[model samples]
Target: MQVAVINRSHHPLPAYQTEHAAGLDVRANLDAAVTLAPLERALIPTGLYLEIPPGYEAQVRPRSGLAYKHGIGIVNSPGTIDADYRGEVKVLLVNLSNEPFVVQDGERIAQLVFARHETVQWQQVAELSETGRGAGGYGSTGTR
Candidate 1:
C-alpha cells in the first residue's frame, strides 16, 4: 500500500533499529514543546501530514520499546486515521510513570500502519430468524 506523507519540518524521521520491522516509526516535532507529567496525557504533534487513499486508514500505534522503557503509551492505542483526513498526524500519549516525561523534538513517538477497511452497509428486516440461544448476551451461558 502507498501513502502520501508531508514533513512540515526538516527533522528526519526515526529509523527502526532492526531489520524486517513491521511498522514505520514516527517522531515528535520538538519545536512544538509538548510535555506531560505522571498520569497525565498530551497530544504531541508529529509534523507529519498524511493522505491516505479511500477505503483505507492509517492506524497510529505505540512502539513497544517506548511503552515498556518509558512507561508511556498511546492513550487510544491504535488511533484511527481516516482516509479522508488531510491533517498533521498527532499522537495522544499518556505517562503512566511517576516522573515527568519530556518529549523532545525528533524523538520516536509512535508507529503508523496503513490498512484497508470495508464500508458497512446495513439492512432492515421486520423479523429475524431465531436460534436456540437467540438474544443471549454477556455470559448468558454458564462460566464452567
Candidate 2:
C-alpha cells in the first residue's frame, strides 16, 4: 500500500485523477520539449524512483486522451516496474499519426498502477489440461 517514492522532477507527485481511478497520472520530466515524428519512439523519463513492496509491481500505461488526440501511444503498453527496480521510471512512447508529436515537461504522459502479482513455480509437466477450446487462438473464438 504505502510504497516509498522519490521525486526528482519539478512537477507535483503523481496522483489519481478521481476517487475511483485505478492508476495515478505520471508526468514527463524534461528540460526541453521532445518531438517524435511519425512512427518514432522514445523513452521519456518521469524522474520518479519507486520502492515497491515484494510481490507487487508498478505498471506504466498510456493515456487515452493523448492517444486519441495526438496519436501518441506507449510502445510498450503497461510496462512493468518490478519491486526491486530502483532506477527512474521511463515511458516508451511512439507517435502513431502522420504528424509529429511534442512531449512537454510536466505533461501527464503515462499512468502508473500498482498491482499485486503471484510468483509462480514451474510444475514441469509434460502436458497441460485440456479446455473447451484447446489450442484455438487468434480469433478462433467468434466475436459475436
Per-model C-alpha lDDT, please? Answer: 0.84, 0.95
lDDT of 1 by residue, 16-53 (tens): 55797767888888666666899999998878888889
**Which has the greatest lDDT?**
2
- TM-scores of all models? 0.83, 0.96
Question: On a 0 to 1 TM-score scale, where does candidate 2 land against the true structure?
Answer: 0.96
- Model 2 residue 111 CA deviation (Å) reads 0.1
- Least well predicted 10-residue stretch by lDDT in candidate 1: 9-18
Q: How much is 100 displaced in model 2, in angstroms?
A: 0.7
Best by TM-score: 2
Question: What residue runs in model 2 are displaced by over 4 Å at the alpha carbon?
Answer: none
lDDT of 2 at 86: 100
Candidate 1, 82: how far from true, in Å? Answer: 0.6
Question: lDDT by residue for model 2 over 1-144, one digit each (tens)?
Answer: 899999999999999999999999999999999999999999999899999999999999999999999999998788999999999999999999999999999999999999999999878988999998889889989954
